[model samples]
Target: MTGYERYLPILLLVGSNIFMTFAWYGHLKYRSAPILTVIVVSWGIAFFEYILMVPANRIGATVYSAPQLKGMQEVITLLVFAGFSTWYLDQPLKWNHWAGFALIIVAAWLIFLE
Candidate 1:
Protein backbone atom coordinates (compact mmCIF):
# COMPACT_ATOMS: atom_id res chain seq x y z
CA MET A 1 0.00 0.00 0.00
CA THR A 2 1.05 3.55 -0.60
CA GLY A 3 1.66 5.82 2.36
CA TYR A 4 -1.64 7.62 1.79
CA GLU A 5 -3.53 4.36 1.53
CA ARG A 6 -1.99 3.09 4.73
CA TYR A 7 -3.00 6.22 6.58
CA LEU A 8 -6.45 6.62 5.09
CA PRO A 9 -8.08 4.47 7.72
CA ILE A 10 -6.62 6.57 10.50
CA LEU A 11 -7.66 9.78 8.80
CA LEU A 12 -11.17 8.48 8.29
CA LEU A 13 -11.27 7.34 11.89
CA VAL A 14 -10.30 10.76 13.12
CA GLY A 15 -13.04 12.37 11.06
CA SER A 16 -15.61 9.84 12.26
CA ASN A 17 -14.59 10.31 15.87
CA ILE A 18 -15.01 14.06 15.57
CA PHE A 19 -18.55 13.65 14.36
CA MET A 20 -19.28 10.93 16.92
CA THR A 21 -17.95 12.97 19.79
CA PHE A 22 -20.05 15.95 18.83
CA ALA A 23 -23.12 13.80 18.30
CA TRP A 24 -22.71 12.18 21.70
CA TYR A 25 -21.72 15.20 23.75
CA GLY A 26 -22.43 18.43 21.90
CA HIS A 27 -25.97 18.47 23.22
CA LEU A 28 -24.64 19.19 26.68
CA LYS A 29 -24.24 22.80 25.70
CA TYR A 30 -27.95 23.00 25.14
CA ARG A 31 -29.10 21.38 28.32
CA SER A 32 -32.21 23.46 28.41
CA ALA A 33 -33.27 22.37 24.94
CA PRO A 34 -36.11 19.89 24.70
CA ILE A 35 -34.90 16.32 25.16
CA LEU A 36 -36.64 15.18 22.01
CA THR A 37 -35.04 17.95 20.01
CA VAL A 38 -31.58 17.06 21.23
CA ILE A 39 -32.14 13.38 20.63
CA VAL A 40 -33.22 13.97 17.06
CA VAL A 41 -30.31 16.27 16.41
CA SER A 42 -27.89 13.81 17.92
CA TRP A 43 -29.24 11.09 15.66
CA GLY A 44 -28.75 13.33 12.67
CA ILE A 45 -25.16 13.91 13.62
CA ALA A 46 -24.65 10.22 14.24
CA PHE A 47 -25.80 9.45 10.73
CA PHE A 48 -22.75 11.20 9.33
CA GLU A 49 -20.58 9.42 11.89
CA TYR A 50 -21.78 6.04 10.64
CA ILE A 51 -21.13 7.12 7.09
CA LEU A 52 -17.44 7.65 7.86
CA MET A 53 -17.04 4.86 10.41
CA VAL A 54 -18.36 2.06 8.23
CA PRO A 55 -16.09 2.91 5.33
CA ALA A 56 -13.18 3.38 7.68
CA ASN A 57 -13.53 -0.17 8.95
CA ARG A 58 -13.92 -1.55 5.48
CA ILE A 59 -10.81 0.20 4.21
CA GLY A 60 -8.86 -0.53 7.36
CA ALA A 61 -9.67 -4.24 7.12
CA THR A 62 -7.51 -4.44 3.99
CA VAL A 63 -4.43 -3.44 5.99
CA TYR A 64 -5.09 -3.90 9.71
CA SER A 65 -6.56 -6.77 11.69
CA ALA A 66 -10.00 -6.42 13.23
CA PRO A 67 -8.65 -6.25 16.75
CA GLN A 68 -6.11 -3.64 15.73
CA LEU A 69 -8.83 -1.52 14.16
CA LYS A 70 -10.94 -1.74 17.28
CA GLY A 71 -8.02 -0.85 19.49
CA MET A 72 -7.17 2.12 17.30
CA GLN A 73 -10.77 3.26 17.32
CA GLU A 74 -10.95 3.12 21.11
CA VAL A 75 -7.78 5.11 21.50
CA ILE A 76 -8.99 7.67 18.99
CA THR A 77 -12.30 7.94 20.77
CA LEU A 78 -10.58 8.64 24.09
CA LEU A 79 -8.30 11.23 22.56
CA VAL A 80 -11.14 12.99 20.79
CA PHE A 81 -13.38 12.90 23.82
CA ALA A 82 -10.62 14.26 26.01
CA GLY A 83 -10.17 17.30 23.80
CA PHE A 84 -13.90 17.77 23.33
CA SER A 85 -14.50 17.61 27.04
CA THR A 86 -11.79 20.10 27.78
CA TRP A 87 -12.24 22.66 25.00
CA TYR A 88 -15.91 22.36 24.15
CA LEU A 89 -17.33 21.51 27.54
CA ASP A 90 -14.82 23.41 29.62
CA GLN A 91 -14.28 20.35 31.81
CA PRO A 92 -10.77 19.87 33.06
CA LEU A 93 -9.20 16.44 32.97
CA LYS A 94 -7.74 15.31 36.27
CA TRP A 95 -4.63 13.27 36.86
CA ASN A 96 -6.61 10.06 37.26
CA HIS A 97 -8.15 10.59 33.86
CA TRP A 98 -4.69 10.83 32.36
CA ALA A 99 -3.63 7.69 34.18
CA GLY A 100 -6.67 5.80 32.97
CA PHE A 101 -6.10 6.95 29.41
CA ALA A 102 -2.46 5.88 29.65
CA LEU A 103 -3.59 2.37 30.57
CA ILE A 104 -5.81 2.29 27.53
CA ILE A 105 -2.85 3.34 25.38
CA VAL A 106 -0.94 0.38 26.78
CA ALA A 107 -3.82 -1.89 25.83
CA ALA A 108 -3.71 -0.54 22.28
CA TRP A 109 0.02 -1.19 22.13
CA LEU A 110 -0.53 -4.76 23.20
CA ILE A 111 -3.27 -5.26 20.63
CA PHE A 112 -0.91 -4.26 17.85
CA LEU A 113 1.88 -6.57 18.98
CA GLU A 114 2.76 -9.37 16.60
Candidate 2:
Protein backbone atom coordinates (compact mmCIF):
# COMPACT_ATOMS: atom_id res chain seq x y z
CA MET A 1 0.00 0.00 0.00
CA THR A 2 0.96 3.62 -0.43
CA GLY A 3 1.63 6.10 2.36
CA TYR A 4 -1.94 7.40 2.47
CA GLU A 5 -3.39 3.89 2.46
CA ARG A 6 -1.15 2.85 5.33
CA TYR A 7 -2.18 5.88 7.38
CA LEU A 8 -5.88 5.31 6.87
CA PRO A 9 -6.01 2.61 9.50
CA ILE A 10 -4.22 4.77 12.04
CA LEU A 11 -6.68 7.57 11.45
CA LEU A 12 -9.59 5.20 11.83
CA LEU A 13 -8.13 3.90 15.05
CA VAL A 14 -7.90 7.41 16.42
CA GLY A 15 -11.51 8.11 15.55
CA SER A 16 -12.67 4.89 17.17
CA ASN A 17 -10.78 5.60 20.35
CA ILE A 18 -12.26 9.10 20.57
CA PHE A 19 -15.75 7.70 20.20
CA MET A 20 -15.08 5.03 22.79
CA THR A 21 -13.69 7.50 25.30
CA PHE A 22 -16.69 9.77 24.96
CA ALA A 23 -19.07 6.87 25.21
CA TRP A 24 -17.43 5.71 28.42
CA TYR A 25 -16.63 9.01 30.12
CA GLY A 26 -19.31 11.22 28.67
CA HIS A 27 -21.91 9.22 30.55
CA LEU A 28 -20.51 10.66 33.77
CA LYS A 29 -22.17 13.93 32.89
CA TYR A 30 -25.59 12.35 32.64
CA ARG A 31 -27.19 11.97 36.00
CA SER A 32 -30.44 10.67 34.59
CA ALA A 33 -28.92 7.52 33.13
CA PRO A 34 -28.67 4.57 35.45
CA ILE A 35 -25.32 2.86 35.89
CA LEU A 36 -26.52 -0.21 34.06
CA THR A 37 -27.82 1.89 31.21
CA VAL A 38 -24.58 3.75 30.88
CA ILE A 39 -22.62 0.54 30.81
CA VAL A 40 -24.88 -0.84 28.14
CA VAL A 41 -24.47 2.28 26.06
CA SER A 42 -20.73 2.13 26.38
CA TRP A 43 -20.73 -1.52 25.42
CA GLY A 44 -22.63 -0.61 22.30
CA ILE A 45 -20.14 2.07 21.42
CA ALA A 46 -17.23 -0.23 22.18
CA PHE A 47 -18.44 -2.68 19.56
CA PHE A 48 -17.65 -0.13 16.90
CA GLU A 49 -14.39 0.57 18.68
CA TYR A 50 -13.24 -2.99 18.13
CA ILE A 51 -14.36 -2.89 14.54
CA LEU A 52 -12.01 -0.04 13.77
CA MET A 53 -9.27 -0.93 16.24
CA VAL A 54 -8.81 -4.50 15.03
CA PRO A 55 -8.38 -3.42 11.44
CA ALA A 56 -5.90 -0.78 12.50
CA ASN A 57 -3.75 -3.34 14.21
CA ARG A 58 -3.84 -5.67 11.25
CA ILE A 59 -2.94 -2.94 8.80
CA GLY A 60 -0.34 -1.45 11.08
CA ALA A 61 1.25 -4.84 11.61
CA THR A 62 2.02 -5.00 7.91
CA VAL A 63 4.11 -1.81 8.15
CA TYR A 64 5.16 -1.48 11.82
CA SER A 65 6.59 -3.70 14.48
CA ALA A 66 4.44 -4.66 17.46
CA PRO A 67 6.18 -2.25 19.82
CA GLN A 68 5.95 0.55 17.34
CA LEU A 69 2.22 0.06 16.95
CA LYS A 70 1.74 0.01 20.72
CA GLY A 71 3.92 3.06 21.21
CA MET A 72 2.02 5.08 18.64
CA GLN A 73 -1.32 3.97 20.02
CA GLU A 74 -0.36 4.82 23.57
CA VAL A 75 0.87 8.26 22.61
CA ILE A 76 -2.25 9.09 20.65
CA THR A 77 -4.50 7.70 23.36
CA LEU A 78 -2.85 9.84 26.01
CA LEU A 79 -3.04 12.98 23.94
CA VAL A 80 -6.67 12.37 23.06
CA PHE A 81 -7.69 11.63 26.63
CA ALA A 82 -5.79 14.62 27.94
CA GLY A 83 -7.74 16.93 25.70
CA PHE A 84 -10.98 15.12 26.37
CA SER A 85 -10.55 15.27 30.12
CA THR A 86 -9.58 18.91 30.13
CA TRP A 87 -12.13 20.29 27.69
CA TYR A 88 -15.09 18.00 28.20
CA LEU A 89 -14.68 17.06 31.83
CA ASP A 90 -13.88 20.61 32.83
CA GLN A 91 -10.77 19.34 34.52
CA PRO A 92 -7.44 21.12 34.62
CA LEU A 93 -4.41 19.72 32.82
CA LYS A 94 -2.03 19.73 35.75
CA TRP A 95 1.77 19.68 35.76
CA ASN A 96 1.69 16.02 36.70
CA HIS A 97 -0.38 15.21 33.66
CA TRP A 98 2.04 16.98 31.39
CA ALA A 99 4.94 15.22 33.04
CA GLY A 100 3.30 11.85 32.65
CA PHE A 101 2.54 12.61 29.00
CA ALA A 102 6.13 13.62 28.47
CA LEU A 103 7.25 10.31 29.86
CA ILE A 104 5.06 8.50 27.41
CA ILE A 105 6.66 10.50 24.62
CA VAL A 106 10.06 9.38 25.87
CA ALA A 107 8.86 5.80 25.93
CA ALA A 108 7.73 6.06 22.32
CA TRP A 109 11.01 7.59 21.31
CA LEU A 110 12.90 4.79 22.99
CA ILE A 111 10.73 2.21 21.30
CA PHE A 112 11.75 3.58 17.90
CA LEU A 113 15.35 4.29 18.78
CA GLU A 114 18.07 3.20 16.36
Candidate 3:
Protein backbone atom coordinates (compact mmCIF):
# COMPACT_ATOMS: atom_id res chain seq x y z
CA MET A 1 0.00 0.00 0.00
CA THR A 2 1.02 3.59 -0.52
CA GLY A 3 2.07 5.68 2.45
CA TYR A 4 -1.22 7.60 2.32
CA GLU A 5 -3.25 4.42 2.51
CA ARG A 6 -1.20 3.13 5.41
CA TYR A 7 -1.37 6.31 7.47
CA LEU A 8 -4.83 7.52 6.60
CA PRO A 9 -6.49 5.09 8.93
CA ILE A 10 -4.44 6.26 11.89
CA LEU A 11 -5.47 9.81 11.18
CA LEU A 12 -9.05 8.81 10.76
CA LEU A 13 -8.99 6.88 13.98
CA VAL A 14 -7.61 9.90 15.81
CA GLY A 15 -10.36 12.10 14.49
CA SER A 16 -12.97 9.53 15.35
CA ASN A 17 -11.62 9.15 18.84
CA ILE A 18 -11.85 12.89 19.39
CA PHE A 19 -15.48 12.85 18.45
CA MET A 20 -16.06 9.82 20.62
CA THR A 21 -14.34 11.31 23.65
CA PHE A 22 -16.48 14.40 23.38
CA ALA A 23 -19.60 12.38 22.85
CA TRP A 24 -18.99 10.20 25.85
CA TYR A 25 -17.87 12.84 28.34
CA GLY A 26 -18.59 16.31 27.04
CA HIS A 27 -21.88 16.23 28.82
CA LEU A 28 -20.21 16.07 32.19
CA LYS A 29 -19.40 19.75 31.93
CA TYR A 30 -23.09 20.58 31.66
CA ARG A 31 -24.55 18.59 34.50
CA SER A 32 -27.69 20.69 34.61
CA ALA A 33 -28.65 19.63 31.11
CA PRO A 34 -31.46 17.13 30.94
CA ILE A 35 -30.40 13.53 30.63
CA LEU A 36 -32.49 13.05 27.52
CA THR A 37 -30.90 16.10 25.95
CA VAL A 38 -27.42 14.81 26.74
CA ILE A 39 -28.15 11.37 25.41
CA VAL A 40 -29.53 12.69 22.16
CA VAL A 41 -26.65 15.07 21.65
CA SER A 42 -24.15 12.42 22.50
CA TRP A 43 -25.70 10.06 20.01
CA GLY A 44 -25.55 12.73 17.37
CA ILE A 45 -21.87 13.25 18.01
CA ALA A 46 -21.20 9.53 18.05
CA PHE A 47 -22.75 9.21 14.63
CA PHE A 48 -19.81 11.13 13.22
CA GLU A 49 -17.43 8.92 15.16
CA TYR A 50 -18.86 5.78 13.60
CA ILE A 51 -18.56 7.35 10.20
CA LEU A 52 -14.83 7.72 10.67
CA MET A 53 -14.25 4.56 12.71
CA VAL A 54 -15.83 2.14 10.28
CA PRO A 55 -13.72 3.31 7.38
CA ALA A 56 -10.64 3.48 9.55
CA ASN A 57 -10.94 -0.18 10.48
CA ARG A 58 -11.68 -1.14 6.89
CA ILE A 59 -8.56 0.59 5.61
CA GLY A 60 -6.31 -0.08 8.57
CA ALA A 61 -6.95 -3.78 8.09
CA THR A 62 -4.83 -3.61 4.98
CA VAL A 63 -1.65 -3.03 6.99
CA TYR A 64 -2.56 -3.85 10.61
CA SER A 65 -4.05 -6.93 12.25
CA ALA A 66 -7.32 -6.86 14.21
CA PRO A 67 -5.54 -7.06 17.57
CA GLN A 68 -3.18 -4.32 16.51
CA LEU A 69 -6.12 -2.13 15.53
CA LYS A 70 -7.85 -2.69 18.84
CA GLY A 71 -4.65 -2.01 20.71
CA MET A 72 -4.17 1.20 18.80
CA GLN A 73 -7.78 2.16 19.41
CA GLU A 74 -7.49 1.76 23.18
CA VAL A 75 -4.24 3.69 23.34
CA ILE A 76 -5.67 6.43 21.19
CA THR A 77 -8.76 6.60 23.37
CA LEU A 78 -6.71 7.03 26.51
CA LEU A 79 -4.56 9.71 24.97
CA VAL A 80 -7.55 11.61 23.69
CA PHE A 81 -9.45 11.25 26.93
CA ALA A 82 -6.47 12.45 28.93
CA GLY A 83 -6.30 15.66 26.97
CA PHE A 84 -10.05 16.08 27.02
CA SER A 85 -10.18 15.57 30.76
CA THR A 86 -7.65 18.28 31.39
CA TRP A 87 -8.51 20.83 28.73
CA TYR A 88 -12.23 20.44 28.30
CA LEU A 89 -13.38 19.31 31.69
CA ASP A 90 -10.78 21.12 33.72
CA GLN A 91 -9.91 17.91 35.50
CA PRO A 92 -6.27 17.18 36.18
CA LEU A 93 -4.96 13.69 35.58
CA LYS A 94 -2.93 12.30 38.43
CA TRP A 95 0.32 10.35 38.26
CA ASN A 96 -1.51 7.07 38.49
CA HIS A 97 -3.49 7.92 35.41
CA TRP A 98 -0.29 8.42 33.45
CA ALA A 99 1.14 5.23 34.87
CA GLY A 100 -1.93 3.28 33.85
CA PHE A 101 -1.84 4.78 30.38
CA ALA A 102 1.84 3.93 30.10
CA LEU A 103 1.09 0.31 30.91
CA ILE A 104 -1.61 0.25 28.26
CA ILE A 105 0.83 1.72 25.78
CA VAL A 106 3.25 -1.06 26.58
CA ALA A 107 0.52 -3.58 25.93
CA ALA A 108 -0.24 -1.92 22.61
CA TRP A 109 3.41 -2.20 21.66
CA LEU A 110 3.31 -5.88 22.44
CA ILE A 111 0.40 -6.28 20.07
CA PHE A 112 2.60 -4.99 17.27
CA LEU A 113 5.28 -7.61 17.85
CA GLU A 114 5.60 -10.36 15.30
Q: Which candidate comes out best when scored by TM-score?
A: 3
RMSD of candidate 2 to the truth, in angstroms, is 1.7
| TM accuracy, model 1 | 0.96
Segments of candidate 2 deviating more than 4 angstroms: none
- Candidate 1 vs 3: which has more TM-score: 3
- Model 3's alpha-carbon lDDT is 0.96
Off by over 4 Å in 1: none
lDDT of each: 0.94, 0.85, 0.96
**Native-to-model Cα distance after best TM-score fit, residue 24 in candidate 2, in Å:** 2.9
lDDT (Cα, tens digit) per residue for candidate 2, span 1-114: 688647976797798788778887888778789999999998988888888888888888887888988888888888888889988988868998899899989999899886
Candidate 1 backbone clash number: 0
TM-score of 2: 0.88
- How well is each residue in 36-113 modelled by candidate 3, as lDDT tens digits? 999999999999999999999999999999999999999999999999999999998999999999999999999999
Task: Put down candidate 1 lDDT per residue, 1-114, tens digits, no spaces.
Answer: 876657899999999999999999999988999999999999999999999999999989988999999999999999999999999999979999999999999999999999
Task: Write the candidate numbers in order of decreasing TM-score.
Answer: 3, 1, 2
Clashes of each: 0, 0, 0
Among residues 3 or more apart in sequence or in different chains, the pairs in candidate 1 whose N, CA or C atoms overlap within 3 Å are none
- Model 3: runs farther than 4 Å from truth? none
